[model samples]
Target: MRNVVLFSFILLFVLLIFCANRTTKNESSSLQSLYHHAKVTSHPGYEHIWPNIEFGWEIIVGTLIGVFGASFGSVGGVGGGGIFVPMLILIIGFDAKSATAISKCMVTGAAISTVFFNLKLRHPTLDIPMIDYDLVLLNQPVIILGISIGVVLSVVFADWMITVLLIIIFIVTSVKAFIKGLDTWKKETIVKEEFVKHLESTATSSEDVEYKYLPSCPDDEPQKKINQGTILSNIQWKKFGLLCFVWIAVLLLQIAKNYTATCSIKYWLLTLLQIPVTVGVSMYQAIGLYQGKKITVSKQDHGTHWPLHLLIVSLSCALLAGILGGLLGVGSGFVMGPLFIEFGIAPQVASATATLGMTFTASISVAQYFLLNRFPVPYALYLTIVATIAAYIGQKIIDRLVNIFQRASLIIFVLSFTILVSAIALGGVGISHMIEKIQRNEYMGFEDLCY
Candidate 1:
């Protein structure tokens, strides 16, 4: 089955590459037409979508680059937009705005694809649920609240500011992943040593009628099991209510902004429609929680404490992640998943639930961009298709590799390396741009930083 999945992915990738090349050959005129239409018809705030024209190799490169980004991203349950945006800017020579727009589209597609993959692979008996719907529900309101605020804050933060922020986030996240991994590795080693000492002691002791092995601590459990009732019963109602209030407030603000600006009915309608679509999943999960549905905890989380502090920290991280991710056209999962693991959520739960949040957030971000007509239609379409496929395959590849290697240290090391490289690359770009701005004395719409 593994071989078959691998072969299928290869075949699909090759086929898509062929299609991408062929499609680009004939898409120049259509792309030009789309640009012209968007320029003439798009609202004032979104004029940045209509860029100068290009064709041929650029399209292929963009698609191939997306494949690489999505594949790398899937390993860590990220949407690959971090890699996508940087590559588009420095490597592909796209302006920051265009790269962000395209990256949002790419993240949207990749997230939805992975969500579908999770759904398709879910089995009540044979397989553990990759996505934690209840957890996703419990967390979605806060995440949505964050994304909403982040989208608003995005405008206040200029391109350079956004770049600077991303650089900081990348560096901090890298350090956290490194420290967290090292700490966990040390704890596991100690546990293993203790287990071995107990075994040796048992062998030497004459009082033992039957040999009994020392059980590892909960932190070192092989699999996690969540207490569904406890999780549902202990829904941080105050925080949850606050998040819900924020969600509603943001929605109303959007409506007011649209109405006062005298934007088209279409924009108003899209905003209204988004509420139900975005919140519907959470509502459904809430209903399930009330319905007394059976909660399936994984092997690792069987008896762990679901603390209020954990919820607080997770939601707080989501808030910042949403803001940075929205501005930079990346998924919050890049930061959120690691934060979850750091906060004592099992790795699988962290990855799965963070992915669920990403899907919704990406959907919301994509819709906002699409409604504004800020997306590059044809180019985004191509990148999205390739990214979607590559992300799924990338995740599978990581899972298989994990099973084969069985080394937590190696996984952490690789993740740390990836994050470190990302920080350097993004920081380098931001610093270079800042230098140019300072030299030119053109700090667009901001006071002098020297002051």
Candidate 2:
């Protein structure tokens, strides 16, 4: 086991190095092309916020954000970019386009590192239902349509809409958070009948069940217990249907909202965060389906329909996530996470699987960005190298810190959302000033002059 783990770590490290080198090369080449073709007056926007935000500071903030995002994602079975992207755009002066691209790139590095760290630590079983080939086959057209539409929109309208949409998302998310907090406080003070009824419903769903199976062997020998048919028949088909419908509706709405938001904000960072948050919330609902279930099946039925169903659900979610990630430059794990939970996957397994899916989706997005010449080479190279190295280091630190907080998962998510809201409220360092500073380096001493 130790040898296997060590080998895995070494392999991941090597892969990281290779990916970093390749990314660096591609980014450098892209940068040169951008510089040559870009209008001399257009000046790449790197220097506008350079003086106000030091490289060290950016690295520190980026690393912390990655760590927080990774830790939350690891525990909640979702990607943390929902928080990271908004924070970067709002707090850092990155335009919507640059922020989304960078957020996806950063999330890819962090997710890969987090998965490696968790696997090395021998995290418990993550049992995602196998992808349903049938569902994938059935939904391929819808998924394709969504992806094609998203990609076309991304190319045509992503630039103008991302910022404005981000501001709106920020306001809405902030209001939601503040209201949730208030509700929590209010609930503590008064236990209304509705609240009590809701709690009772939740508790009843979480209650354990008792069952007994009849002996299968003949009386000639000692009787052996056989799985009861009653148990299988008792499967809550209605509840399952309800759960599936709720999650499906949530997933569709989230995708629609995300597409709408991306059309407006065009900032990849905020978009990255929004999509994953939607996925995570969806996963939370899925987990409820398996909260208190005991299934003892006969060997014959043990592997029958469940795996197929799981596979279909997982694939449907994963494909949707990948398409969105590819088109919008965010991790698709948001969609995958909830689907895994709904399909009866364990939390840790769901998280690991979701991260794995995000890794692929983010990679595709990065490749597409490169092919489309959406990234400037020097900036891409610098940011990718920095993010990758930092993510590796951050993962180690996050693993160590994970033990300190009992509810670290929930805390990390709340904090991530809070940071995002605050950043969005800040107006991404103001649009006019951002354009001016990028066009001319006049803002270099503005901070010091103001002070």
Q: Against the true structure, what is each candidate's TM-score? A: 0.68, 0.44
On TM-score, the leading prediction is 1
User: Which number leads on lDDT?
Assistant: 1
Lowest lDDT sum, 10 consecutive residues, model 1, at 209-218
Cα deviation at 399, candidate 2, in Å, is 4.5
Candidate 1 TM-score, true structure as reference: 0.68
* Model 2 bad stretches (over 4 Å): 1-80, 83-92, 121-149, 155-304, 307-316, 319-328, 371-373, 389-451
lDDT of 1 by residue, 1-451 (tens): 4774677567656656666565566456553543333442223444454443344455557667777777666556666776787777765556667777788778777776666555443211123454555566555655675565566566656667777778777888878888877886776567557656876767565334321112122243232122112323434364345444545554555545444433356655544554564455445444444443523243234223334454455456666676666565567786777776675654545665666667666665565566656666756776776778777776666545543433344345445556666667666777788789888998556432112
How far in Å is the alpha carbon of 386 misplaced in model 2?
A: 4.2
lDDT of each: 0.58, 0.43
- For model 1, the stretches where C-alpha displacement exceeds 4 angstroms are 1-61, 117-128, 187-307, 408-414, 445-451
Clashes of 2: 23
